[model samples]
Target: MNKNQPTRPDGTRDFSPEVMAKRNYILQTIRAVYQRYGFLPLETPAMENLDVLTGKYGDEGDQLIFKILNSGDFLKDLPADAVTSMGSKKMASKIAGKALRYDLTVPFARYVVMNRGTLTFPFKRYQIQPVWRGDRPQKGRYREFYQCDADVVGTDSLLCEAEIILMINEVLGKLGVQNFQVKINHRQILNGIAEAIGAMDKFSDICVGIDKLDKIGLDKVMQELADRGVSGESIAQLKPILAFEGNLQEKLTYLTTLFENSPNGQKGLADMRAITQMLNSFAQAKDFPTDLHIDFDLTLARGLSYYTGAIFEVKVEGVQVGSISGGGRYDDLTGAFGVPDLPGVGFSFGIDRLYDALEELNLFPAEATVATQILMIGFDEASFAYCLPYLYELRQAGFATELYPTVEKKIKKPMSYANNRGIPFAVLAGSDEMQVGEFSVKNMLSGEQQRVKAGELKTFFATK
Candidate 1:
């Protein structure tokens, strides 16, 4: 490859047709599940006001937002000192007023706040769109990728949370992800832990450090807390909580006593219990995955600061990748936009990582990548013209049919095209076949050829 050749920017990708087909398979599965749960489709602008995105994603996330430079003379309005001496942060605010959205949830909150009066209460909406993050590119992480999100606003019902869990099971199962754990935690639980450890003032630091417990070990996390100004005494107190382990009931019992004096912790425990109880009832009465383990992980603190209630992160076993999906309840996300009292809970499916996992596991079905059922090839112009009506008829009969472009004198060219594209069937139309009032249909896989009349093409492919 020449160095001078123009290339795609780092951290982004150009998806070929084959990759897109499999991606669409994942998207369709998620969309169907969302619709089954009664979520209407929604879309928001790709760019949001810089202020709307800046303070929402925490300090680390704010750094990853891709800002758009102001058009025209952006610096013309700034003072000479402001233009030359201001730090990057201050200059950024003055120079860039818009940025690509970091995630769908914040923009959804902005949308709900703007359209509150015209919308129904408890609005259930699903948004599947690309997001941009200016982080270093790595396997399963991208600067530009799509998120499939489903959310319910205007209600604080724990049922929404329960339903979200059920949907998680359904969506992953449908996508053929066999071994995955839906790790659940709550913000108040972390708060209670902070209070128990006397690190109340350092709750955010604690959550951020704890979120890395899986990647970095507990000792490092404790050291990080200390480095972040957490008390040595508090670190000692939190060690036991970090090492605590048990079944769901056992963990709940332990936390109940630990948080007995903490009302926020108690509230979190109540919500967790209620949501699990609902899930259990469904398992007993309906078609639920009996083996689905709701792992109550204390260290699963999603780094997003907006999550005010339950937080969730799903890890796929047997795959060396990050969480494939995550989300949580936000009691006042819309409130940030001046619409208070609209509590909501939701989750997002990270399609890019999910695709990687599925591809690695070889779970995508063969039919998922089949773009065309048949390709019609002709050896001459008249023969190609003859395939036009047949192409129309096959498509009308609900078959994905396509006429091979160009007029090739030899069968080698068209046959190579069909074989390379994995097109299952090919209809060969020549003067002889047209004269006989029939077409030569060949199965590209088996090399089985059969002469079928024009009227019988539909039935012929249908039976195959």
Candidate 2:
């Protein structure tokens, strides 16, 4: 092995058996929730055209993107002068035209645009896949991680947003997360600040600054905004909203007055009002958790500039990390791909952070291990062969079955292996049982033993 190559980067982790079982259960439950709402599964390649990703996420997101190196001596045509002068971006453009996808949303937009003819309208998809980034890894932040996303394309209905909000609520409930709040904002509301203060030209810069609100606090956010050329008047306009402390209604009334002149801002406020109305309807029907409330801080700017409408961020009360899941509506993501007007709204559950939240909250279910249900203990050479049919029969009956493949390890070794693996059942087949048309069914958990007819092996596990 090459020592210099090393194993994995910081901020990333490998999931062992027990951890993965818990993660898998979380994913499966979320997937079930997505499907019940008629969302279909979709997948895109892990890498995509560099141009497809670059400008979509603004500057900081571009910095986080992991660019893949070109293969097969493709960089042989390197111009020495350009190489020296242009550095990474210029050189990369010539040699590397593709990159590992930074997030599922962009690639999904590309997919929808390319396959628009083949798919139906209101395309709903759930993608659970790993994404690569080059960001500095810290606790709950990985260089590579999975995103479980559900999105609806081709419409901008407020009901879609409502359904997704409830969907998020349902999955979190099922995952056993009790104390959490879904903080929501709209990009248009964010845009309102820029519009209100005439900093609309530097919208991206404003967003990048404000996205750090949770991380840097209000004074730093305002300082960052000012540093980015936002006028003093603009910063002051943001003060009351950022400092506003009240329920959603109180904040909304203040925000409406503040953004009264801005058409886009008022539209965002209307959308929020409609969403609140929908939430009230759900509450009347008893479908939502009472604690799920919107916090409308002017500072809640999601970093992505493509978010054209309602944006979401989920967080727990006492945790110090970033948002566990976030997303929003993008009206022109498809337009970038030449498929105009295909609006899409979606949310991504940050697998790494969500895991951290559950771990911190001590909400993970009692671990169900990956142990085999039956370990066919091979007493001798013929015993394994004899138990092979019984193993196959038991497996066909839906039990996870494995065989102790080596005889050099004695009965004690296999039993110890079963114990280490948390295996509950062992089919102890000896020459005597083979001849007698029976096998000893050992229950590793209860330490009970019983004889089972060969034909009844399948029935035993089936009923079990």
Identify the candidate with maximal lDDT: 1
Q: Where in model 1 is the C-alpha error above 4 Å?
A: 1-4, 73-82, 85-95
Clashes of each: 0, 0
Model 1, range 20-118, lDDT digits (tens) per residue?
999999999999999999999999999999999998877889999999999999988788888568888889999999999999998998999889889
Question: Model 1 clash pairs?
Answer: none
lDDT of 1 at 336: 71
Best by TM-score: 1
lDDT of each: 0.90, 0.83
Residue 212, candidate 2: how far off, in angstroms?
A: 2.9
Task: Tell how far residue 242 is off in model 1, in angstroms.
Answer: 1.6
